[model samples]
Target: MQKLLKLILTSRVYEAAAETPLEEAAGLSRTLDNRVLLKREDLQPIFSFKLRGAYNKIAHLTEEERARGVIAASAGNHAQGVAFSARKLGIRSVIVMPLTTPQIKVGAVEGYGAEVILHGDNYSEAADHCQQMVETTGMTFIHPFDDDLVIAGQGTVADELLRQSAGQMDAVFVPVGGGGLAAGVAGYLKALCPEIRVVGVEPADSDAMARSLAAGRRIRLDSVGIFADGVAVREVGHLTFDLCRRYLDEIIRVDTDELCSAIRSIYQDTRSIVEPAGALGVAGLKKYVRERKVSGRTLVAVNSGANMNFERLRYVAERTLIGEKQEALFAVTIPENPGSLRRFCSDVLGDRNITEFNYRLAGRERAHIFVGISIRNTGERHAFGQLLGEHGFDNIDLTDNELAKTHVRYMVGGRSPEAGHEVLYRFWFPERSGALVRFLGSMGENWNISLFHYRSQGGDYGRVLIGLEIPPKEEDGFREFLDRLGYRFVEESGNPVYRLFL
Candidate 1:
C-alpha cells in the first residue's frame, strides 16, 4: 500500500497531461440540494484521462524497450492515448482495434502516427489478436490497465483532486471500466486521507467489478451491453480489482436511462457533452444522493471523458426525460367506439400533457393504445395508472420496459395473427458494412421474417429486433445457425411489449 502511494506521489504524468480545473456544478447542486464539484478530466488533450497513464507508462520504459516500440489493444479512447503519447516520445506504436470500429476512431489513431491494425469484431477479440502480434513482433505490450506504472500514473488524478479541493470533500465518485481510474483514485485518496470516501460507478449491465467484489474474486461476463461502449469490459483487471476492493467504499451500478439522464444534467451544468461511460460518475452520484437523501454535503464526481459519437445524442435525448421522471409511458385498453379518443382525453387524461399517443384500430371490441405523458414527478406515474384503472381502462405501465421504449413505441400499429410459429429476437450486430447482408444471407430458405425493427446507435453495435417464422422441427437448426453467425442475441418472443404492440 505504501509502495503504491509513494509511486503515485512521484509518478510522472504532467509531462504530457495537464492539470484540469475542478469546477462546481452549480446547476446540479441547486437541483440536488448539495454542493457538487466535477473534476473535469474531460478537458484532457485526448479528451480523456487515458493519456496520463499511457504517457507515464511509456515514459518509464527502458531505453531498449523504447527502441522496440510499443503495442496496445483498444477499441477507442485508450488507443488514441497510446498513439498520441507514443508519437510524442518518437516511438513507433501499433494499435489493434476491432474491425467494427468506426473509421473516425481509426483515423484518429493514424492521425497520431500509429499503425492502426483493424482486427476481430470487438475489444476482447482485438486484445487476443494483439497478444499474438506482440509475441510475433517482440514489441513491448502496454497493458491499458493492471500495470504498476499505469496505475500510479492514473493515481495522479487523486493527487490533483486533493490539492485542488483542500482535501475537504465528503465523497468522490469515479467511473470504473477495467477499474484503472477507480483503483487509482481510491488507492491514492484512501492512502492520504483514510476518512475520505471513494465510490466506484459502473454500468449495471457491465458491473464485473461489483460482481467480482461480491464473490471475492474476479468474474468474467459472458457478454456486456454496448450502449456505454467505453466501459463495457467483460472482466476487471487483477491489480485494479485488488486496489478497488481494498480502497473503494462501494460500487454503484446504474442503468442506461439513468446514465443518459446524468449526461443531460452534466451538459446543463457545464455546457459540455460527455459519453455514456463518462457520465457514470454523475449518474451514480445522483443515485447515491437520491437513495440516501443526504443534503448540504460536498460531493464530487469525475467527468471522465467527452469522446461522444454524434449520433447517440438522439438516443440520449429521448431517454433523458424518462430517466428524470419527467415522462411516463403506458399501454391502455379502451373501448373501440366512436368518440372514445375524445373520451380518453376528457375523462381519463383530463389536461395531462401527452408526449406521445399511438393508436390503431385492429379489433372491433377494443383498442390498445400506446401513450406517453408528461409527469411532474416519479410518483405521478402511480397516480396516473390508478386513474386509468378507476376509469374502466386496463393499462400496463411501460415506463420501465426496455422493449417498449426501444422497439414497441415505434412499432405499435403492427400485428400479424396470420404469421404463425413466429419467434422474436434482439440481436447486437457489428456495425460494419455488409454485416446485415451477411445475417440475411445466412437465413434458411424455409424460414420467413415476419417483423423487424432496426436501430443503430452509431457505435460498435447495431441493435435489431426481428421476428421469424420457423417450423417447430426447425428450431434446433435455427439455434445452430444463430450460434454459427456469432452475433450476440437474446430470444425476445416472450417479451410483453411484443404482445402489446407487435
Candidate 2:
C-alpha cells in the first residue's frame, strides 16, 4: 500500500494527461441538499481518465518493449486511451474491439493512429482473441486495468482529489468496472484520510465487484448488461478486486434508469452529456444519500468519462423523465362510448401533460389505453391511480413493470385472438445494416412472426420484442432455433403486461 501510494504521488501521467479540475456541481448540490463536487476527469485529453493509466504504463516501458509495440482489447474508452498514449510515445499499437462496439468508438481509436481490429461479440471474447495475438506475435499487452502501475496511475486522480478538496470531503464516489479507478481512488483516500468514506458504484446488471466483495472472491457473470458498456465487465480483476476489498467502505448497485437520471443531472450542471458509466458515481451518490437520509456534507463524484455516442441521446432523453420520477405509465380500462375518453381526460388526468398514449379498440363495450402522464413524484402515481379507481376505471400501474417498460408499452394493441401458439421474446442484437434481416432469416420459414417491435436507440445493440407463432409440437424446434440464434434473449410470452396489453 505504501509503495502504491508513492507511485501514485509520483506518476508521470502529466506528460500526456491533464490535472483535471474538481468543480462544484451546484445543481446537484441544491437538489440533494448536499455539497456535490465533480472530479472533471471527463475534461482529460482523451475525454476519459483512462489515459492516466495508459500513459503512465507506456511511458515506463523499456525502449526494447516499446519497439515491439503494444496491444490491447477494449470496447471504447480504454482503446482510445491506449491509442492516444501510444501515438504520443511514437510506438506501434493495435486495439482489438468487439464487433458489437459502436462505430463512433471504433473510429475514435483509429483516429488516434491505432490499428483497430473488430472481433468477437463482447469485450471478454475480444480479449480472448487479444491474448492469442500476443502469444503468436510477442507484442506487449497493455491491460486496461489490474496491473500495479496502472492502478497507481489511476490513483493519481485520488491524490488530486485530496489536494483539490483540501481533504475536506465527507465521501468520494467512484464507478467500478474492472476496478482500476475504484481500487486506485479508494486505496489512496482510505490510506491518507480514513475519515472520508470511499464508495464504489456499479451497474446493478453488471456488478462483478459488488458480487465479489460479498462472496470474498471474484465471481464471473454469465452475461452482463451493455447499456453502460464502459463498465459492463463480467469479472473484476484480481489485483483490483483485492485493493477494492481492502479500501472501499461500501459498494452501491444502481439500475439503468438511475444512471440516466444522473446523466441528466450532470448535464443540468455541466452542460455536458456524459456517457452512462461517467454518471455512475453521481447515481450512487444520490442513492446513498436517499437511503442513508444524510445530507449537508461535502461529497465528491468522479465524472469518469464522456465518450458518448450522439445517437444514444435519444434513448437517454426518453428514459430520463422516468428516472427522475416525473413520468408515470399506466394501463387504464374505460368505456368505449364517445364521451368516455373525454371524461377520462378532463376529469381523471385533469391538466397533467400526457407524454405518450396508445390505444386500439379491442372490445365493443370497453377499451384499454396505455398512457404516460407526467407526475411530480412517486407518491403522485398512486394518487392518480386512486383517482382513476374512484371514476370506475380499471387501472394497473405499469411504472415499475419491466415487461411494460421494455416491450408492452411500445407493443400496445389489443391481443390478437387468431395469434395462436404465440411466444413472445425480447432480444438484443448487434446494430448494423441487415442485422434485423439476418435475425429474421435465422428463424426457419415454418413459423410466423405474429408481433414485432424494434427501434434503433443508436447504441451498440438493438432491442427487439418478437412474438413468434409456434405450435406445441414445434416448441422443441423453437427452443433449438433460439439456441442457434446466438443473441441474448428472454421469454416474455407469459408476462402479465404482455397478456394485458398485446
Candidate 3:
C-alpha cells in the first residue's frame, strides 16, 4: 500500500498543486466540542475527487493504449473526470450513462469533449453495457476507482490531507460507494499512520460495502435507494473490498435525512451544496461523535462532490429541516363535513403548514378526512394529535408510511353512482407554503361527489389517480371544458374495478 501510495503521489494526476487548506468548521466544531476540519474536494476542478483517479490512470497508460482511446461508465462526476483528463491528454474518450442521468450532468460531460452515450435505466446497466463495448471495440476500459491504479490515485487524497494538516489528525471520515475511496485512504493511512482512525461512511439504503465487511465477503444488494445516486452502489469492487477489509477501522451508515441535513449544514457554513453521497462523511462524523461521546478529537470530513441537481434542492432543504427536528409529519384526522377543514385549519393547524392532505370516506360510519400535516416540531405533532382526539377524531401518524407518503397522495377520489350528477378529478399539488390551501381555495367544491387520493412522492408532483362519476345528462361544451383542466383522469364510475374495489 505504501509503495502504491508513493507511485500515485508521483503520478501525473497526483502531481497537481497540493497544500489545500483544511480549515476548521467554526460552527460545527463548536457544537460538537471537537475540532472539525473540512477537506474540500467539492472545490476540486471536476467538483469531485474522481479526477485524481481518472488522470492518474490515463497518464500511466502506454502510448499504444492511449492511442487506442478510452471509455468509462458514469452518470456524472466520473464522466466529467475522465472526459477532462482525456481532453488534457489529447486522447479520445467515450462515456456511457443511464438515460435518466440529469441533463445538466450530461451536458457537463459533453463539455469536456467526450462522446456521451445515453443508455440503460440505471448505473449498473450502463456499466454492463460499457463493459460489453470495451470487449467489442478494444478501447481501454477505465474502471472508476476499482482498479489498483485508480485506488492508488484516490489514496492521494489522504496524502494531500496529511500533507496539509501537517500530520496532526485523529480521525478521517470518508464516503463509501464501491469502497474505492475508503479502501485507498484506509490502506495508505493504516500502513503509514497506524494510530490515526479511518472511518468509512455510507448511506443506509445502499450499504453494500459495510454489509460485505460485516459478512466477511462481498454480497450484492438486489435493490438500492438511489436518493444518493453517487453512492447507491450494489456491490463493492474486488480490489477495493480487499483493501477496506484489511485497513478500515469502521464503516458507519447514515439515513437520507441525515445526509440532507449535512448538505444543508455544509451550504450554511461553506456556501456549497453537496450531493447526498458527498454529505455522508459529515453525517457519519456527527453520528459517531455523539454516539461514542468523543471529545477533543481532531476530525477531518471529506466533502466528496457537489454535483447536485437544482430541482432536488427543495427536497434536500425540506428533509434537512425534518432531520434536524425543525419539522414533523403528522396525520390529522378530522370530521368529514362542511367547515371541518376550516375548523381544523383555524384551530389545531393554525400555526403549522399543511404539507399534504388526502380525504377519503373509506368505510367510515361517520365521514373522516385523512390529512397529512407538517408541523413546526415533534411537540406540535403530539399536540395536533391531542387536539384531534379531543374533537372525536383519531390522529394516526402516517408520516413514515411509504405508500401514504408517495402513491397514496395522488391515488384519490372517485364519484359513487349514488351521487347522481358530479364529475370527479384529482391532482398532485406542490407540498410547500400554502400550495395545498391555495389549490383548495382556487377549486371550490361546486360539484363534489367522488373519491380523492394524494400521497407524497418526495417530489413536487404527485401521481394522483382520481375517478369521477360524470353527470348522465352533461352537455358537450361543459365536458370539453372539464377535459381542459389538464389532468390524467380515469372515469371509473362505470368501471368494474371501481364497483368492486371502491
Pairs clashing within candidate 1: none
Could you tell me the lDDT of residue 432 within candidate 3? 43
- Best first by TM-score, ranked: 1, 2, 3
CA lDDT of each prediction against the hidden true structure: 0.91, 0.91, 0.74
Q: TM-scores of the models, in the given order? A: 0.98, 0.97, 0.76
* Model 1 lDDT per residue over 253-318, tens place: 999999999999999998999999999999999999999999999999999899898888999999
Where does the lowest 10-residue lDDT sum fall in candidate 3?
Answer: 492-501
Better of 1 and 3 by TM-score: 1
* lDDT for residue 142 in candidate 3, whole number 0-100: 92
User: How many angstroms is residue 73 displaced in model 1 relative to the true structure, after the best TM-score fit?
Assistant: 0.7
- Supply the TM-score for candidate 1: 0.98
Off by over 4 Å in 2: none
TM-score head-to-head 2 vs 3, winner:
2
Model 2 lDDT tens row, 1-502: 8988988988899999999999999999999999999999999998999999999999999999999999999988899999999999999999999888887888899999999998887677899999999999899999889888889889999999988989999999999999999989999998899999999999999999999999999999988887898998989999999999999999999998889999999999999889999999999999998889888999999999999989888888888888888899998999998999999999988889999999998888988899999999888988999999999999989887767876677667797898998999999888766678877798859799999898878787888988989999999988998899788999987776787688
Q: Pick out the ten consecutive residues of candidate 1 with the lowest summed lDDT.
A: 409-418
